[model samples]
Target: MQIFKKFSQLSIFYSEYVSFPYPHATTVKKAHKCTINHCLLHSHLVSSHASHKFVSSGGKPAGGEGDGAGAEMVGPQRPQFVLFGSSIVQLSYANGGWGAILSDVYARKADIVLRGYYGWNSRRAVQVLHQVFPKDAATQPSLVIVYFGGNDSMGPHSSGLGPHVPLPEYIEHMRSIAVHLQSLSDTTRVIFLSCPPVNEAKVREGVSGIFSELVRTNELCRQYSEACIELCQEVGVKVVDLWTAFQKRDDWLTACFTDGVHLSAEGSEIVVEEILKVLKGAEWEPSLHWKSMLTEFGDDSPYDLVAFDGKTTLNPSDWTFHRAIQWD
Candidate 1:
């Protein structure tokens, strides 16, 4: 299917394969030092409609189906969940990146739509909120995991040019985003990830290589994180307190972050745990947990291992991923 035109305009590079050139580094520390692989392969170049022809409820082809053409109720639509935020979200598919982890867990449960922009902050996020979560969406995302404020909480560069959004404005922007996402659909749910703490030493060590004149301090990040938590509590939105969670781990300072800011694989694991905890504990109806969700398509009944008896007795084995047959 053709991607929404507006969404196409926003995303220049869609999806890609990730492979690192670590040269068989032996130590975990050496692997951590390896640069993040960016061998991006654009997966959206091919049109989804090239193979299948979807017709509207009116029996017309999908392109110009016009009104009331809600596919499935109008072609088949898969359940969708969105991950929207800044670099933390954009680079999620990286090796062991948190977004990649969620994609793996929810592989057959739901489609994970990634909407991340590198170096973007709450200020910029608010400006493009509509395009990301359009009002005319045929089906809204069941869940949206939001991450921002890391850049927003930065100590402004001396040149006065950066993604630093004032704390009060940041809070308001986040609140607005939450409201807009919640308003998208009654089924839409939002989870905010508070900004995580940064290692001041590492930020000074390597951040300049990425963004000269960039400044970040744990103190600043903590304040922003506190603000996000407070905002989530006030608005009755679910949140993953990344700042506190990272701190709770004894090795977070050295283990959780790759360059004092971005998440390391270890850090991403923490994110996965936190997000799963929220999904399992939230009071949302019709839970979206991978274990709880029914896999798409029916069971692999045809592949079930049958007994080699001459008689046609039905003896299925679990080796073929066939759950116990319910005798209704």
Candidate 2:
């Protein structure tokens, strides 16, 4: 499902040298790209015998037959949860990051897709909102976790070399991000993480040797966090106020961050907890919590378990336990 939306975006992304049409077809169009569009119900996929070289539209062969054995197109397999945000999210997979934790917790239940971009603020996120979460996705994600504001809250650099977006624009960008995700599908839930606090004593400016001032502070984070929560409340979207949450910890300043800006293992744990709190409390029809989602193939095959008697030898049929819960 996620791959379905990456078509044009990836094409544009690799437009420099590589180009292709069908995601499954053994075809290509370089300097170039595309000639086949497939639907899910089709019996066979696209291929090209004449122009496997990718000179023309080597669409699906007639009567479900292609030059070679038809490649099976990837079908919908599991629910997807996307983490979309700035640097915090980009680094969420390293050093016991929250995203990595979520992946571990949700194993076999769903796919947690990371769409983080470092050094990005609300303004940068707004520009790629459509590309990341296109309105025309064949299947929208079951959930999207959004975090953008910390960078935007940075004090405007004297030479305008920082990622400081005005307060008003930040609000609007966040609002748009939420609205777009909501519009993806009625069940496509969004959880926005507000700006987290920074250790004033440890944070510094002149990042990338580009700026020459103190451009980040807890005070600014507070304002952005407040605005984020207010906007979420107004639009009925779920929000995690990281600014207040971070400060609640007694050792937040020293224990929670690697450099007073990024989160450490302990801090990332808080994010995981807060997110679980929302997921557990929300009234989404099929819950996304690990416990709520049944395991994929149920328990081990009956053969793998201790058999006290001949009746316990169910073997392959015992795997049916996983089918107890249905997506609908």
Candidate 3:
């Protein structure tokens, strides 16, 4: 059985650079440089090598192929969750990004693969699908979340534009992505996230540079987001309709987005909530509690016991249990 944590859209709010063809030293170094927190980069590094038998949940190479390995029985293959799309996906690992929050919550249970490229649209995403996700079973992810349309939905007239993908082409690209993912593994799932609604007032008033002119309007975003929902429905894929969900709340402009386009902390929280709902629908069981791992507990219980080294014994009673759950 695999444990998968919900992927957060918040990781896309900030900008970061990741080199092509993973497991490269230079890629990790550049990631560390762009990230606000080094810990996030470290977490990513650990996730990258998660497929190996020796890699531990902590991201370090532990155990070996030879003697005295009895105590080090291989752990269940950890689930991998991939984030694919534009800068929003890249920035999702930022301090307040959704990807960072997801990494914290799903820490030991799963690995969050960051494949977001800044300024990329559905067209560009299609070109790198094989590189990001291979046909190999070991590299297959439990869930692949595609977050696009922000750039694709940009008004055709916007000046100094980004790689604008037309709506019909965008829909086909999304469908193609789903088809390709299905080809990879039958068990793996795909979730399509609708483009977020942009606040034209905020962009015009506060946002600077090419982004100010290039950002799409709320109306245009709605069109694209609606199309995403339809495509997902037609293709039998799950969808997180952020465009509709965000506007349902009053003053969502200030509540959800940092600028007119990016997400604020509160906005990221909303995205997580929506994603969790989709996970629940897919019947993802929540993680076990600390108290359930106590020595006094019975083996008949459904929950997993606290994992520890065979060389060291842990007293569950010694641990402090808290009900408060916080994600930042």
Which candidate number would show the highest lDDT if scored against the true structure?
2
What range of 10 consecutive residues in model 3 has the weakest lDDT sum?
Answer: 315-324
Model 3, range 1-328, lDDT digits (tens) per residue?
1111233222312224443222211232223232333223222222322233322233322353342233322145566788888887888887478887776555545677898898788988888888777887575777888898898888664564567788999999999899998788766788889988878888777746644445568888889999999999999888999988888899897887777788887787778778767875664333122221122221111122222221211112221111113321
lDDT of each: 0.69, 0.70, 0.64
Steric clashes per prediction? 4, 1, 11
- As a TM-score, model 1 comes out at 0.70
TM-score (all chains, Cα) for each model:
0.70, 0.69, 0.65
Off by over 4 Å in 3: 1-76, 157-161, 207-215, 283-328
- As for candidate 1, its clashing pairs are 1-48, 1-49, 16-41, 72-75
For TM-score, candidate 1 versus 2, the one ahead is: 1
Deviating ranges (above 4 Å) for candidate 2: 1-75, 205-211, 303-328
Tens digits of per-residue lDDT for model 1, 4-93: 111222223212222211121111111112122343212112222222222222233344443223322311465687999999999888
> Candidate 2, clashing residue pairs?
21-34
How far off is residue 63 in model 2, in Å? 37
